[model samples]
Target chain A: MKLQRELQIVNRLGLHARACAKLVKTANQFESDIVLRQNEHQADAKSIMGLMMLAATQGTRLTVITSGADAEDAMTQVQHLINNRFEEDE
Target chain B: MLSLSGTGIGRGIAIGRAIVLDQGHNDIPCYRISATALSGEIERFNHAVDAVRADLKRVQRNLPTDAPPETSAFIDVHLLMLDDPVISQQPVQTIQEQQQNAEWALKSHADTLIDFFEDIADPYLRSKKNDVAQVVGRIMGELAHSPGKQPSDLATLGSSLAEQIIVARDLTPADTIMLRGRNMAAFVTSLGGPISHTAILARSLGLPAIVGLHDVIDTIHNNDLLIVDAATGTVLVAPDEPLLAQFRELQQQHLRHQQRLTLLKSEKAVTQDGEAITLLANIELPEDIEGLRSAGAAGVGLYRTEFLFMNRPKPPSEDEQYQAYCHVLRRVEGPVTIRTLDLGADKQVDGGRPDRETTATSALGLRAIRLCLSEPSLFKPQLRAILRAAVHGDAQIMIPMLSSLRELEQSLALVGEVCAELEREAVAFNPKVPLGGMIEVPAAAVSADLFARKLDFLSIGTNDLIQYTLAIDRVDDSVNYLYDPLHPSVLRLIRTVIRAGHEADIPVSMCGEMAGDPAFTRLLLGLGLRHFSMEPSQLLEIRQQVRQSTLAGLSGQVTDILNCVETGSLYDLVDQLNQTDSD
Candidate 1:
């Protein structure tokens, strides 16, 4: 199964280093091939370096694409992280 | 012998071997690594990363368990980032693919990451790039450091290097404090402003330090004989046999002079003609009162209360300020003239923000009394604090940078209002606390009699007075050549203020650099200035001159010297005046 969901970056600092690390660390937990697409730019969701290279900031909309088994679960977890602002009050 | 010039912090001389310390972030040397050497380079890189991790872990362990969560969390973030492939793995890949050395590869990736961060629109994100680079730089520093030679701090040095002069790129306060027990001969930094914590720490420690050398770290090697003459901010890398002998003799002479000063500390600052001079200390902080008992100071003439209000988030509460003033007053036996908040004019209370502009009208800006009067809420607490502390010990109020009687009157009104409130609340305070005004402005100095009649006493802060009067910023090295303490016009002003204060039946004290200087001790004594307030370090030496000179003897000559017009003749006469006391 494959799942694709578009989400807006709600964290005040957006996908900065700290947030990117948390996002990548969370995505690395699943067996799904996860990629985050911002505008025309795309990054492997499990790679901190790749996610940071995306340079996503607050109000930036990102498309999350996940494939293989548990792809739906991967999308859900990522959506949760983004919605919680990576659990960062900032 | 080799000579290097830098900004000197204190006046002292030292002779020692140089210990070139690789402090803070140092640029790493870069070179190519052969394919055959790639594995070894990788191993070296891994070793450095491990070393950095271990160092951080040690620091983490040293932190108290009850330490702020943010501090531990900060360390945790760095530790997690170390494990991140971006910092640890990317550099290794660069080393292998580029066939470059570990240090260079690490820096290259770090720079790329930092640059990526810089492109981020958010300022907060951009600032985090420094943290990433610094963590990477730590590994780079470890790899670049020569084997068996760790960066030196006073704590790390063995007794053998006790006489070694500290040569560093820069220092943190923690690094400086750990330098005790080394009998540190001297300190020379490649970077620091005069008011930087490093320079101020060196001054307080009474260490010979020359800062802002630009390249002292690279030029001077470890164990090279170093001759540091802080009086001139000159660092001679190595001296010839004859020059070495000369420096050794000068070292002894410096020691002897120090001993003489210490011996003179017990003596009263009384002139040969039986006229007594009040020698008081001009302190900036409570910490500066460490050795007031043996400093031969009657009391603190100027407790610059600005330190409490500066580098802080907001104006200190009345009680917070009261405790700080009380801390100093209760420690000292004599009266402490607390100068109410002299902030602004280089010292701003923006919670330690970087300065934006000095080109703006800095010296003439709304600072000191002007700033206080503009914000009564800010001014009221400080006044109340001084009043409250006066109940504990001999405390007096001194306002700074007053140009007119209106400023004085307004300040008095605030103090009066605070006292009334304290009375209404039945809070104990000395309502009779002697209120004085600092005469640093030309206008105030000229109108000394009017201010004298209204105030209890007057202190001539010649440092600012001279700076303002001659239109020369005293701290500006370029224009400071015009900052002559012995200028005829300056002396005439000093004489005028002292005479004005006397005629008005008030005592005038000088609490500037000129007051403590032995060169002007007799000259000021002759001018009929009664009280002398200077740095605690300078009080004894000034007292030594006071006990030796006859004020009655020098008054006649001082009058003629004051009347001299020619600059050359005036300098000659002033030099002669100093000679008479020495003779």
Candidate 2:
């Protein structure tokens, strides 16, 4: 199964190192292969270097693609993390 | 002698030799590897990565339970980088395809990642390159088999570096955490401002640190004798013998002074005449609570809430403010006086409202109670939060810079309005929480008796009161010398406020720099300032002074000091007052 959705980075510091680490940790938790695409740049969601390379600042929208048996759960969890501003205060 | 200066973290002095941490990025050997040697080089690369992983994990496992979650999260980022295919597999591909040495291949791949981060537009995201460099640096150190390049090595060389100052380009959170449990004398970093991780860690640990000393790592070397005076942010290298002797003497005196003050921590802040004085802490950050606890303060007298509202794009929500207030309330044992939003003036809140920007530029402009009164959307949430958080402990609201009875009435009405709103929503709040005012404005100080009648308590903010009474901008170096706290008008205003609080039967506290000054402790006591609030560090020192004074004998000298015509004579009288009071 495969699913796709777009989410915005809303945290104050954007997808900085820690936030990227959080995203990668969440992505690696499932069997799904997750990839995030921001504009022309696409990166494996499980790669902190890839996410950092995208340089997604606050309000940058990225298309997230999850494909596997647990695609639904992965999508749900990834969406929740981004929307929660990576659990950062402000 | 050569000296470098930067912002100091705490009031500490250390004399030691220096040990510089080279981030190990300067030199890299680029060379071709023979086919057979290429495979061995790749294995060597894998081994280094694994070693760094174990080292980082060891540091993580041994972290103090009290370390902030961010510290672990920081190490997690590097750990994840170690596992990520971009970092782990790319260098192997480089070694296999290019037949390059492991160090050269890894450095090339790491440089690509760091260069990508550098091109990012956002400054914050751009700085994330440091994390990548730190992780790569660790692996590089492992590959080189250098002993002291890795921070984990600090633990292994603990005894040798124990009496030496650590000079680093910058310290990662993990480095700081590892250094915390060590007996390193001080830290001098080539990078970082006052709010950086190194600065915060040094302050919390009471370790002397000087940061933002650019190129300091290159300037100092291992075994270079050094003197660190954090009070002046000075790091002196190889001072002359006579100057070294002088500093050694000063260091001894400082140690003796701190030891003497520490002995007074458990003693009550009461005069020799048997009058008990309340010595509370003026807290700006949550970290200050530790200092307050160690100093044995009565409670938090002025909890500045402006810090919550500043440095953010939007004002904190009502829930956030309530949680923050409750955090302090639960930690404190006695009354915690939460000062309402004192933003504007010099403290410009970034995203509060673009329209209010112009008004916030001047000291006398729309600020403090004025700004809060004009913007109910900004003010109501704080009012509601304080009222609700009051349920958790003895919380009191103290409004700042209340210059008139009309503003006081408007503030009170807003509080009432907030209470009604909370009631409508059926929220649990302390409706009877004490409401106080800061008597900083000369007008408010003059008419403090009237305001005292309407308020629960009053606190004299002598810093602002002295600044305004003397019409001097304390920040301006030219006129600050004239900014005298002992000016006749300033003394009269303080006296008036104290007398008014006495007559109105309300507690009057001084929550300014003056309250903590031992020179003025007796003077204020003579003028009847029974409640004092100051920085947590000053509490014990002030307590020592308070324990030696008899208020009965001070009154006569205080009157003379107050009536003295010349500033010179006034200072002389105060000196005489302190001289006679010494047991």
The global C-alpha lDDT for each of the candidates, from Candidate 1 onward, is 0.78, 0.83
**Weakest 10 consecutive residues of candidate 1 chain B by summed lDDT:** B351-360
After superposition, which runs of candidate 2 have C-alpha atoms over 4 Å from their true positions?
A: A1-90, B2-249, B358-360
> What level of docking quality does candidate 2 show?
medium
* Docking quality category of candidate 1 according to DockQ thresholds: incorrect
> Candidate 2 chain B: worst 10 consecutive residues by lDDT?
B146-155
TM-score of 2: 0.57
Poorly placed runs, candidate 1 (over 4 Å): A1-90, B6-11, B15-205, B209-225, B238-249, B351-361, B581-583
| Native-to-model Cα distance after best TM-score fit, residue B142 in candidate 2, in Å | 24
Q: Report how far off residue B472 is in candidate 1 (Å).
A: 2.6
Tens digit per residue, CA lDDT, model 2, B1-583: 7898876766788889887664554466455665766777788889989999999999999999999989999999999999888778999999899987677888898989899888888898899899899999998878766432222234355544677888877775546645645678898887765545576557545678887777654566555689989889999987789878888898888889888889888988888878999999988777779889999999999998876765568889999999999999999999999999887765677645546665636768788899889988999999999999999999999999999899999999999999998999999999999999999999999999999999999999987898889887643434534767889899989999999999999999999878876778888988889999987877887898899988886777777877888867888887777777586
Report, to 2 decimal places, the DockQ of model 2: 0.55
lDDT of 2: 0.83
Q: Chain B vs. true chain B: TM-score for each candidate? A: 0.73, 0.65
- Per DockQ, the best of the predicted structures is 2
lDDT of 2 at B266: 91
